[model samples]
Target: MFLLLVQAISLLLVPPLQSYHLDNAFGNPESVWNSLYYVVLLLLFTGAMLIIVRYKVNWLIQAIMAVAVLSTLVYVLFGLAVLLVPSVDPLIAGGVSVVLSLLLTALLIVYPEWYIIDTVGVLVAAGASALFGISLAILPTIVLLVILAVYDYISVYKTKHMLKLAEGFMDLKMPIMFVMPRRWGYSFMENNKGLPAEGAEREAYFMGLGDAVMPTMLAVSANAFLSAPPLLGFVNVPALGCILGTLVSYVVLMYIVVELKKPQAGLPFLCTGAIAGFLLGCLAAGVRPF
Candidate 1:
């Protein structure tokens, strides 16, 4: 439910993000260069994380992540401020957003509790998803998703470095992943014993923030780039199809992992579902998929 809420919030923010004429960091969203840049950055960051963990420089990781969170929150809050008050000056909106972002980031740094992390995390995820969603066009977004899916599989199963990274993040107890307590009164702040043993039933369920963000990019991209008529408000037929497909896939993924205790890469299932649904929806709507 929380993951779904994040995507919905991201979709809601798309119009405002578009209203501000937010463009991709790389000039053309359709270009493959944007995807290449993203991959290179991801590789570098992952390598750096592994090295940090190997050296036991966990504090450094936490600091870098804190900075990352603050910046993402600023972008989200700034966009929302201008969205809610059209007449507000950009400078003022930016100022207010910074202050609020600082406060929220501070809370994460200080308290570092489950609910606090979740509150700030939702903002960061939605903002990042919407930003990337609109910035990358349909084809590039799909390509990126496919590439990341392969990468996720390799990192998790082949290299197993991703698992190591998760252990490091768990030690930090930061806001990078969403946390839900299976039992009442479970406290993430004090659950410092580290992640449960492999195949052990965890007291709290954890989902990566990326899982929510990646699938959402496809939905946003379809809405932004597809020629299909809007099925409801700003959501086009293809985009809505992606949403439905993503939700269904999420259900299947959760069942496999949460219920059956089988661990698998999430994006392969999610991206495949979104792509299939988007294409099917496009065809049904008498529109081109690409």
Candidate 2:
């Protein structure tokens, strides 16, 4: 029950990075380069993870996990603090941001509890979501989501690289993915026997943050760029639709994980839901489908 609440709260606290990335991409082609850079980072991360898994070096895994957690904390703090701080200059903001982020990161390195991981995850998720949402327009977000879904399918089912990625990441004990334990004193490190036995049902669950972030990118993008009337709390038709669709998709996915006892690539379901909702929103707003 607590874990379930944590999941919901985590989603609420962290906005995905997709929206901010989208906004930047919409602003300039350079922004697309920036997005591509992250992909490179992810690929690099994937490679390192493979190496870590292949060799079974526990200490290096822990070190990488620490670095990832710390880096995420930096971005999370900087993004949120920039909004509240007095100075608007990028330089001053950057300095203060670095200091604060490092402080938080240092704290996590010293002591990492469940609360700390979840808090950092929420902060990072929000930063990423806002960044991508603002940069990506409706069409781009849709395209990105579709492309990612296909990639996820290939990675998870065909190439089988994604499962490897998941296994390696789980060993790191990072919050890049949602972590839930079915029972008390369950150690992710010890129980990390691999990605749930390939089809076996398990009480605990771990979902890559990417799964959550990718779909929400469309939601935030639709809201930020679309000119339609606000449907809920100043968000426009597209935004409302995207949010509803995402929640619908999340619920469905969670249900499948819990009740259906099946393994599935989440992006396909999420993207489908978001696209359908976006179209419906376009119709409601009297906008012709392009």
Candidate 3:
């Protein structure tokens, strides 16, 4: 349910986000430099996160993450408000965005409840995915996905630093991870004892925000860049294929988590599924799969 919710919200946000031209750091989506730039930025972010965690500066990290969340939420909300009220003034939209994002930030800072964290996590994932999707063209997006998938694998399976980072973030109760409790009685705030042991029947399942955001980025890119006719009002055939592929992979990843009872790197499965589905979609749509 959490996976589906995030993907659906992301798909819904893409068209409006594109309308507002909310691309990040890289302006020219087609440039190889764009991919390289993003790769570097991601590495830097990971390093910074690890350093912050090592230093036990969780509050500082939370503040930075909150600011980022607020900025992205403002972008998404501003775009959505403009779409809903086409004649709305930019200043009015900006004010609405600011107020809404600030309210959300406050809720996160104050309550930090599981439901609130999950809800805000979904919003942040959608907004960030849409932003990156619009920023990178097909080739760059694919490169980004593939590279990140590999990095995720190395971080999870090899270095295992990602696990450490997750532990730190979980302690902060920030929206960095999505919380899906197995039972309604689960409380994330009280349950900060770290992840369950391998093969353990856990009280809840946790997935990183990147796990949800990365695959959706491909869907958003396809919707923005592909010329195929819309199969569902918001997305083209290729984008729809990407979305379906992601959900399919999510099922498999969950099976590994639930049935096999293991910790897995989600992006490896998700990116592969999306890329394969995207290629098939491109073939079906009669577009070059480059």
Full-model lDDT for every candidate: 0.83, 0.62, 0.83
Stretches of model 3 off by over 4 angstroms after superposition: none
The runs of at least 3 residues in candidate 2 whose Cα sits more than 4 Å from the true structure, single-residue gaps closed, are: 1-48, 56-72, 82-100, 107-112, 183-194, 198-201, 231-234, 260-262, 288-290
Q: Candidate 3 lDDT, tens digit per residue, 31-84?
A: 867877888988899899999999999788988988988998898778778778
- For model 3, the run of ten residues with the poorest summed lDDT: 16-25
Which ten-residue region of model 1 has the weakest summed lDDT? 256-265
How well does each candidate superpose onto the true structure, as a TM-score?
0.94, 0.74, 0.95
- Model 1 lDDT tens row, 109-134: 88888888788878998898899998
Task: Predict model 1's lDDT versus the native.
Answer: 0.83
* Shift of residue 213 alpha carbon in model 3, Å: 1.1
